[model samples]
Each structure stands twice: as structure tokens, then as C-alpha cells.
Target: MNLTLKIWRQKGPQDKGKMVEYKVTDISEHMSFLEMMDVLNEQLTNKGGEPVAFDHDCREGICGMCSMYINGEAHGPDRGVTTCQLHMRMFKDGDTITIEPFRAKAFPVIKDLVVDRSSFDRIQQAGGFISVNTSGNTQDANAIPIDKHAADEAMDAATCIGCGACVASCKNSSAMLFVGAKVSQYALLPQGQIEATDRVKNMVAQMDLEGFGNCTNTGACEVECPKGISLENIARMNREFFSASIKG
Candidate 1:
């Protein structure tokens, strides 16, 4: 297939960026989106032109680093997959693909398709973990009985990869879904009960501090999320936050 790619190019955070067009010919449907990009970069490099800069690692879709806004959709037209897992088959021959970086005030563009997502790391650090006593007196995690339904829900929430699709897809660039998932992953588990109050409060505080917008219940985040994280997590987080507020 022959394809025209209109990709965003920016030298730095302060650089004025625009969509630059490039053409790739003879692309196979079997090639992953990033692989097709590799072909485009190879063409550019051979012609002594600068290659397009996009973030990608572990192209199998686990790393959550392959961030792209394709034709106004997070992770392209496909559902429940990251940019790296997208394939050429999703587009027809001679298609014009518009590729851009995931836009959010919290995620400042670095260069080309790369954006600074360290804000997510900071949010996680705010209180996404539990303090476990590893001493001899500590109870065995396996011995603790957890309700199957709660365990399943917790596992579902744990699937969030922090890819920012939730933020990019939201009209307000809300990180609530992501934060909710992170919070729910703990809130539903017995091990997380100890820090539940501080966990929700601190994570929400950090999310707000990072300039991410508030959620208006649009449900765009769950629709675009690769892991299919549920809106129920957001509700759970809200309940946790409200309870924490009352306790304080």
C-alpha cells in the first residue's frame, strides 16, 4: 500500500510545530504501525533528512510508550490497543494518516511525537504504593482470603498502563480515570486498606497539581483506554475520596 503520513514535527517544547507530510510505498498490512514508521524513517535517513521522532519500546503493546494521536483518535482507529499494536491493514491504500502527539497541558511536547510524561511518575509516587511489613511477624499474603469479585475488580483496575489515552481522549484532559484505576487497584484489596485514606487523597492532590483537568463523566477515557479500564474505578475513587474527606 502507498500511504501519506502527515505527522507533527517540533524541535523542542517551545518550538512552533506543524504537520509535515511524507509518503511510504509498498507497505504490507502485516507491518505494525511503528514498523511502517521505521520504513518512513529509513527513507528519510537514506535521503540525508532527519528522521521523525516518536516514542516506542516493547512494541508488543505492554510498555505504553508508543503514544500517538492518529486521525483524531487515541491509538488510531482500532479499539483496545496501543499505537505500536496498530497495523497498516486498518488503513486503505493511498490513505492520508494524520499522526500527532497526545495533547494535554500536563504532558508537554518534548520533540516531534515525544512528550514528557514524568508527571504520571510523580502522581504514582504521591501515594500509589502500600507499606508492607516484611518482618517475620508479617502475615502471608497467600493466606489472606479475598472475595473473588473484589479480586477480579482489583485486577481489572491494575491493568491500567498510564498511557495518557484517558487524558488525551478527554475533552478536559482529565486524569481521573487513570488515578481512579490506580486507587481502585489498592482500594479493593485487603493489603491496601492500611493506606486507603492517604492513598486516594495524595494521588488526587498530585493529579490536580500536575495541571490535569477534572472529569465530567464523558466516558471518553474508558473508551480509548487500551486496557479497557472501567468507569466504575472512577466511581470507586470518588467514594474513597469522599470517605477520606469525611474522616479528616
Candidate 2:
């Protein structure tokens, strides 16, 4: 396929940026989106032009590092798929693709298509883990005997891969879906119950401190999430937060 790519370019966080256009020819339909970028970069490098910079690791889509806004959509037009998993075939010949980094105040661009997502790490650190002791031989996995329904719900919530697509797609740049997923993952599990009150309180507080906006129920985050993380998780988070607030 022949394509025109309008990609954002910036030297640093503070540098002014703009969209620069490039043309690519004879791209394979089977090529992953990043691979297509690789081809574009190679051509630019050979022409003595600076190559475009983007982030990717584990191109298989497990890493969630291939963060790109393609044609005004997070991760292109596909639902429940990340940028790394997007394929060239999704576009046709002569398609003009506009690529930009994930846009959010909390995710300021470092350069080109990379953004600093350490805000997510800080939110996770707030209370995304269990605090139980496991110093000795761990108890059998079956010993806890979590209810099947609860276990399934928790597993679904735990599938969140920490991708910032939720923030990227939100009109308010909310991290509610991501935070909700984390909270729901533990809220349904026995091990997570002990600190449930403190967990919700601290994580929500940290999320706010990170400059993420409040959820407006536009449902954009759930739509763009590569994991198909549910809006129900956000509802669950509301319940958890309200319950915790009252207790506190």
C-alpha cells in the first residue's frame, strides 16, 4: 500500500512541535503498524533526515508501549486493540494517516511519539497490590477458595495492561478506567479485602494528585481500551470509593 503519514515531531518536552508529512510506498498489508514506521524511519535515515521516534516493546501487544493516536483514534480504528497490534491492511492505498502521541497533561510528550507515563506507576504504587505477608511457604492456591463469580470478575479486572489509552481517549483525560480496573481487581478478591478501604482512598487520592480528570461517563475510555476493560469497573470503583470515604 502507498500511504501518507502526518506525524508529530518535537525535540523535547518543552520544544514546540508540529505535524510533518512523509510518503511511503509498497508497504505490505501484513506489516504491523510499528513495522511500517520502521520502514519509514529507514527511508528518512538513508536520506540524511532525522528518523521519527516512537515507542514499542513486545510488539506482540502485551507491553502496551506502542502508544499512538492514529487518524484521531487511539490505536487506529480498531476496537480492543493496541497500536502495536494494528496492521497496515487497516488502511488503503493513498491513505493519509495522522499520528500523534497520547495527549494528556499527565502524559507530556518527551519527543516525537513518546510520553512520560510514570504517573501511572505512581498511581499503581498508591495501592495496587496486596499487603499480606508471604514470608514462609505460601498457602495452596485452592486454600482460599474464592467464589467462582468473584474470581472471574477479579480476573477480568486484572487483565488491564496499564495502557494509557483510557486517558488518551477521554475528553477530560480521565484515568478512571485504569484506576477502576485496578481497584476492581482487588475489591473482588479476599486478599485485597483487608486494606480495601485504605486502598481505594489512597489510589483515588493519588490519581487526583497526578492531574487526571474526573470521569464524565462519556464512555470513550471503555471504547478505546485495548483490553475491553468494562465501564462496570468504573461503577464498581465509585461504589468502592464512596464506601471507603464513609468509613474514613
Highest lDDT among the candidates is held by which one?
A: 1
The C-alpha TM-scores of every prediction are 0.98, 0.98
Q: Which RMSD values do the candidates have, in order? A: 1.1, 0.9
lDDT per residue for candidate 2 within 70-169, as digits (tens), equals 9998899988889989998899999999999999999999999999999999999999998766889777768888999999999999988897999999
lDDT of 1 by residue, 9-67 (tens): 99999999999999999999999999999999999999999999999999988888989
TM-score of 2: 0.98
Q: Compute the lDDT for candidate 2.
A: 0.93
Q: Which residue pairs in candidate 1 collide?
A: none
What's the lDDT for residue 239 in model 1? Answer: 99
